[model samples]
Target: MKRWKIAGLFAMALMVSAAPFQAFATSPEFAYTAEKWASLRDNKLEYGEIADLIHEYNTTVRQNELDYQEYKGKTSTDIAEEYYDSANEVSERIRYPDDDSANYANQIASALNSEISVTNLTEQGDSNVDDGEIKRLGYEQQEKNLVQQAQKLMISYYSGKASLATLEDAVTQAETAYTQAQTRKAAGMALQSDLDTAAEAVTNAKASLQSAKSSLEQTKQQLIIMMGWNYNDSVEIGSLPDVDTSVVSKINVTSDIQTAIANNYSVKITERRLANSQSENNRATYTNTLANQKETVSTNVKNAYNSLVLAKDSYDQAKTSYDLAEKERAAAELRLSAGTITKKTYEKQESACLSAKTSMETAKLSFLTAQVTYDWAVAGLASVS
Candidate 1:
């Protein structure tokens, strides 16, 4: 519910952003049609698409398995059918000695059954398959994330009640600044540069608003793609419903990180890459294990390990930054109300808050991915232990 609420809020923001600034007494008219976004959200996608893809992949793998037992029934039937047909032909041909039909029949039988030895299609259940499955799941999870993000955008679009409040503030700021600039110009109290600067600020603010709208639009498209829609297909976003945020705030990042590490696809992919490299090293060592080659292998391992660690650190920093930003925003608001800061300064503070939030979101994602990779590596190491 919280998620939906956030989405609704974002949707409202997007809508406002999509419209003219109204702050300049004139909103820019763009040829933006919300038809696509609306269409997409209205249609609910079934989980069948993903399930079917997985099923097909599994069936193909099973078919390729060289267990021989899997094909026993079909193999036996085919062989028997050939033998019976040959026997009938031989019986008819045996009526004459010149025929050699019996010999031919025996040869046919031998050809069909004698050389029916099973050939292994591949090494059964290699780590590659396991890793691939994990990666597919990871891709699915990424899709889900995109979908949820889209939902957030939708919520943002509809949450006009809240968004209007902020947007109004923005408009007021722009208008007031514009008026101040014009009044100073008329009174010859300010240079043209000052007026221009003020005017530019208003324009920049409009651009920012539009960019935010564009983001929501892009996010909607992303959700469509995640749901397995073609890129060319447009979706309509539905009216967003409110969601509860309590659960979101209550989520334990550390625990979620651990879970992601254990099950996320990104980790599996990295693990697979590392495994392949390790396997190459093993082969190399056996063939011509040189000091330099050994060192190279060690270096590769360290590089992969370092990536995971760096990602983890980035996430941690982002989370901390976000928390600090929240505190700073609070302080900034208070200062503004106390007349210790200008409205422009307050806006700057708000921008900082948004930046901090963005950083935190990015970091959380990175941390989850890193945790997954680290887990995959550790899991592999465990088997060796």
Candidate 2:
């Protein structure tokens, strides 16, 4: 019965020691699997899906998530418990020692003392730092940054497409102008210098168009790759949702600053460290660090809010300009119908209208970006030092 009880205790100790390692092996927090990536390849990437996509596809963020999981799985307490359990098992065996009884007892005593020392050290370390929580917060911060980057890439890709449309129109207009200039010069109605200038404009416009096309392609490639697609893979990028400028009116800067300070990962980590600081010097240093981080978060949130306001103003101005451009283009169409404006002049007005439309689209995207930045700031992922 004694032997059976000892064996049972030893078995239970082994199981207890292995439990954390088993959990660590099975825990897959933020794990990115190949199947997940394969499934995403066929889906159209939208702005709203950027955060999830980044969490799965971004190498750095995925690695950080894994690191956090590993840290949490192998916590100091878990390790200390495992050591203590091992020492208990060895001490239990010492109770039924035979010819090497003294040897077994010495080993048991040594193991228990070592386990105690290890437990003390681990407890002291845990008291000084919340490593698991800090790592988890770090991973969260990284994911937020990657999400912002992916969003910016999406905005750039669409904005480039808009600019590409305007450039293509400009190229067509320039070519038509060059042909008309050539015709007028042949009839001696236009100066040779005028024809030369028109030819130069056509060359410049075509070069600009080509450059814009290349730039747009590069942006598309970046966005697709970030979305976990091969660089050569074909995927349709959906258009961004229309910006709602009214959100600016709902922003409360002072309230947002407080929220940012509370949510900010850096500020929170510093606070944790400050709480764990045992020495007066270390506590004071962390206190000052905490204050600086809070201040930085406050400033970042305020700046993001201000930027959103500016973006709103710019969008409003661009909308007004676009409205005016549309009216002028309408009048120019009538003038063309009445034979008062040449076809080239009317086309120039149309190009101007297209340019205005592109400006408005770009401004709207800028406002959206600012809105995202501000929202992220208030949520505790402010971009600051």
Candidate 3:
């Protein structure tokens, strides 16, 4: 009766031990969904977080690759981390066989298992684990890098000091118009047309404000999408710090144009794509003459260089126009307020001020576009080194 009671307790303990292993074997799968991805990105992720995730995933992939090589009867460069962890834990459980061991114990009733048996038991352990591995992402890295570059572009698009500077000058002009109208209304010294013109300037200012707001939101969305977020995902950016005026001032016609050609992300992309095209062309020509190939390459280089020069010249012109517009707008506003200008003249001044602001924004866009084009062109022709 005592033997049977011991058997019953042993069976109960076996079931209890096996239950956890069974549960672990059937662990739920790791899930990823669009909504969940959005939530995680919002709540737990940042730009740096993505970089860390890539690093960890790369490590796991390397481990898996080594294990795969080992399984294929090849020399692996590294051992599996899991293998080491398991070996350390299971070493304590292993005991050497003894010549005078008791025969009463069942074959499977030993307190510990041998190393070979343990390895066999755990051979399929990885099958049940959710490794959460992402595939080779070299191309994806380029895509991600481009997206990040795009975000920087969008920020510069909206929060540029050039645009802000132009807007401030316009605001001053509008305020001046308002003051002049008020003075004229009070003194009965202003024409009806003058009052009407002043009112129109205020309306234009409000319109300009709306335009800025719209552009800001659009650029913000562009940045969010570039960072690999859904269109509806909310992003709260910290305030933009003042861009280095020194850097801005350091941008000269010749040196900046040259630097932009080399460093602009867009230009680099274009350059890479063009080089890829050249390689494809070379590969396809099984019996082409060396001179012909050289000529073709030369032609491409010339076209790209010319394009860069044109872009640089356009940037220079835009900068001059923007500066001149700012000056003219400010002077016009001052003249209108001093009653030296008639209402019709004041309206013309308001128009000129708005035109200047618009010109400045356009110039900024042109400069960036050219800069990107030049960079991509250079990248096509040369390696990242």
Clash counts for the predictions, in order: 37, 0, 9
What residue runs in model 1 are displaced by over 4 Å at the alpha carbon?
A: 1-180, 197-223, 230-302, 335-345, 369-385
lDDT of each: 0.46, 0.74, 0.47
Tens-place lDDT digits, model 2, residues 1-385: 2222332353354345443322212223334466644444445787776876665555565345445544674443554455556655644544333546768877666666766665665555444545566667777777787787788888888888878888888778888889999999999999999999999999999999899889888988887676556676767787787788998898789988998998887888888777756668768888888888888888888889889999999999999999999999999999999999998788788988999999999998899889878888898888558
> What is residue 193's positional error in candidate 3, in angstroms?
3.1
lDDT of 3 by residue, 1-385 (tens): 2222332353354345443221112111133456543443452334333432232222232233333322332111112345545755676676655556675254335534556655753553322211212111223334345533553455455545346555656677788878878898789988778888888987887788668767776776665544444455656644333322233233343543344345433333333333333235533442233234334434444454555566556656666775786787678778888988876676666666666666655655554544444344333331222
Q: Please give the lDDT score at residue 212 for candidate 2.
A: 87
Best by TM-score: 2
Give the local distance difference test score of model 2. Answer: 0.74
lDDT of 3 at 322: 59
- RMSD to the true structure for each prediction, in A, is 18.2, 12.6, 20.1
TM-score of 1: 0.38
Please report, as a residue range, the 10-residue window in candidate 2 with the lowest summed lDDT. 20-29
Model 1 Cα lDDT, one tens digit per residue, 1-385: 2222333453355455443222211112222136523332344433222322222122222122212222223322343344555555545443222345658766666544433321111112121223333334444444344433444344444332323334445655787788998998999999999988888888877776666666655655654454444454654444432222233345444454444344434444444445443256544543342333333433433444567567656766777887898898899999999999997788878866776766665555554444434434333221110
Better of 1 and 2 by TM-score: 2
Q: How many Å off is the CA of 281 in candidate 3?
A: 15
